[model samples]
Target: MLLAGAAVAAIEILHRRYDGAVARGTLLDPSARRDRTDLDGTLNYLLVGSDRRPGESGPDQRSDTILLVHVPAGTKRAYLISVPRDLLVSIPPAPNGYGGGSDKINSAYEHGGGGEAGVRLLSATLARLTGLRFDGAALVDFAGLRQVVDLLGGIRMCVDTPVRSIHTGRLFEPGCQQMDGTRALDYVRQRYDLPDGDYGRQRHQQQLLRAMLDRAGETNLRDDPVRLDRLIRAVGASLTVDTNGVPLQDLALTLRGLPPDGLTGVQIPSHPETIDEVSYVVLDDGGDQLFAAVRGTRVPGWVTANPRWVTRL
Candidate 1:
């Protein structure tokens, strides 16, 4: 434990001095917030994957991927909800800098720079749509993502359906297996072959997450100090967390109790709907009830439908 502490501290210092530019602030005083198990409010986080790669040139920047995480207090159980980027909902653009009226949620990032503008738009939209207050956020780049995967050595995953993509050079046979950083990235990014398109991609990501968690549990960090240090450094550098002013040590302690099976991953309830000749994922009754439940800190009506997906309270 002492060694792990020292290693994490060293990495934090190095990152702050060199590669650190993710400034932390919030609508609420996150610094003063505590992760109370007794609180009725859900702990929400927005995970955005920016489409700003130099390899793909585009004037418009969007979140290629979006994940909303909700962790109820006092339980090891957690929920991850993936939002489709092309769902075509009204996105309130940045106020001053990127005023283009309501558009797709992805455009908010293009209007506002990748930093504060994007975060503000996302958080505000979430509050309006779900009536739930988000407590923190974590941002990561492709490089940071690669580092995290490598740190885990590799994650084992089972391919549910055949996913073949010529662009990303990914081909998977349906079965359980191990995936390295490169393969894992390709798997999560592949959407062309899947039947549900972006929805399928989200499912794949969630599956990978489950496999990674399982691997994380089995991993023995104390066996290799060098590797542990490398992982700690990579994770710290890769994530931009809005920890509500909570100390790093305290946060770590909070996460200590989480188990692999404790995580419940769900996609926001929506099916394809056409509007103005454009396809949109209109939220169904399930979606509305889910958000309502989140706001009320109670199980939504759809929760019963997804008995397998929702962790037991």
Candidate 2:
């Protein structure tokens, strides 16, 4: 799970209890997603992590991370599904009627005008690709990640492999350790040296989110008024979400009550392939089976059969 998508879940808990502390947006197009008529009662939220850096000027042209938060009909558990940004797909045209063709999935942002428009087009592309409808979407950045993690007094992350940050040269040994915001950002961005490369980074990203959710579960914010206020404010500003016209408070209420540790993270089965000298991810036949299971709200069954594909989050 990307920080932005994790922010969606975190904000859901905060908004449910605190009543209104998160920023909201109109980021989805009602007509863009698939009609929910044929599929099971599954709710999907598109969490997009924009590639804009801390000092970069101008709009984000690529999505560094893309995740789908899937809540099955009973809402007993949620799945964090990672979509590789380099996956090749046919992008749909923007609302303004410009730019649509076979391209990397991350390029949808630039092709769709780079803000809320980018989110809508990305959602549309995913909907067409997965035959899934999005109930909501969110755009989250890394700067807010620093604020919230620091505000919470940092998070505990267990690194599975030794990673040296490419950005800061900070060595993260293979063990569970407490990490501040800046270190967490740098750690999550170290993909090049990992064993599974980007897939390993995705797993690290997913674990960071689970840690945030877990740490937040441990804190009793109401007991500390000052921290509570600052934390709420930080969380509220970190996310820009569209609940597809559903009230944020109501959706939060509906989303609460799942076990704090019940999040399941999975990556679609794919392999890196070079097409015309350009790298792209091509999903295997198992991805089709996984999508079929998701469509029927039977991912548990899919997981049981394809256990290797499920990341232990």
Candidate 3:
């Protein structure tokens, strides 16, 4: 009887696993995502990551990553806001009863513990600067990102130049190739290969991200049980969300409403500029124009009514 009971439990677990996988794919409706019809309307999320290693021993600690996503309902258009990590900004007082002062926009995560603090600081900062209200925030570490690629069995990307820079101690060549967990991270994090330094690295990272998403659509992970389990575990382990904000189901629903290709990449404007006697990537005049378009209710005609940026490859 005990042996039979163990068998039953194992079967139940497997059943639940497959059930969740199917739900993640089929449960998503591509037409129902939109701002709430009642009260305050649509939702947007500020997805941010920090160079500051959370609970990890690392000398590198600061804000060096940001991605703002806008999701509206029943539309194919989604806006991706990529804010440069080095953008100079005033960091507000710590939300955890601790005080705060001015710091880079990315350091908000490190100053406050990880979840609410980071999200609050960013939401406040963006509202003051760009007039966009965030519904919630989610944070993912490099490991989580790596696992995501691995689950898809690696992503294929074309390297425009010979990527021979030593970053995090890995070297890659230029060409069309497939990247696993380690190589993907290395590709996204390298700065020495590009002449523009961090700004170039950010552009490469965004490209890598888009490539990964493209590859995912062609892969079996969306229907494969083992892969889905591993991917979810990795994401669940590394991701933290503000519970007082957008629920996962609601967020997923919003994501489902938008056709993947309709989303266009939006990077914060920055050209080289001197700040406090140090060279930094400062927002150009086009920066305000870009953010204004993002803050507006309608998607720009350039993005919504055109397919100019589509990757034909």
Per-residue lDDT for 78-139 in model 3, tens only?
Answer: 66767777676666565475476655666655565544445555656666667665555565
lDDT of each: 0.65, 0.80, 0.60
- Tens-place lDDT per residue, model 1, 1-313, is 9999999999788556433434354522222133442223456667766655544424356666777777777647677788766665555545555554655556655555555456567666655566666656665554456667778888887777898875666679898888887788788878878887777888777766677778777889879878876777676655556666665455656767778787777777778777788766666667777887766766544566766434331
Query: Sorted on TM-score, highest at the top, how do the candidates line up?
Result: 2, 1, 3
TM-score comparison, 2 vs 3, better candidate: 2
Give the range where candidate 2 is weakest over 10 consecutive residues by summed lDDT.
Answer: 31-40
* Per-residue error (Å), model 3, residue 163: 3.4
* Pairs in clash, predicted candidate 3: 33-73, 33-74, 34-73, 63-106, 93-100
Better of 1 and 2 by TM-score: 2
Per-prediction TM-score to the true structure, in the order listed = 0.81, 0.88, 0.75
Give model 2's clash tally: 0
Scored by Cα lDDT, where does model 3 land? 0.60
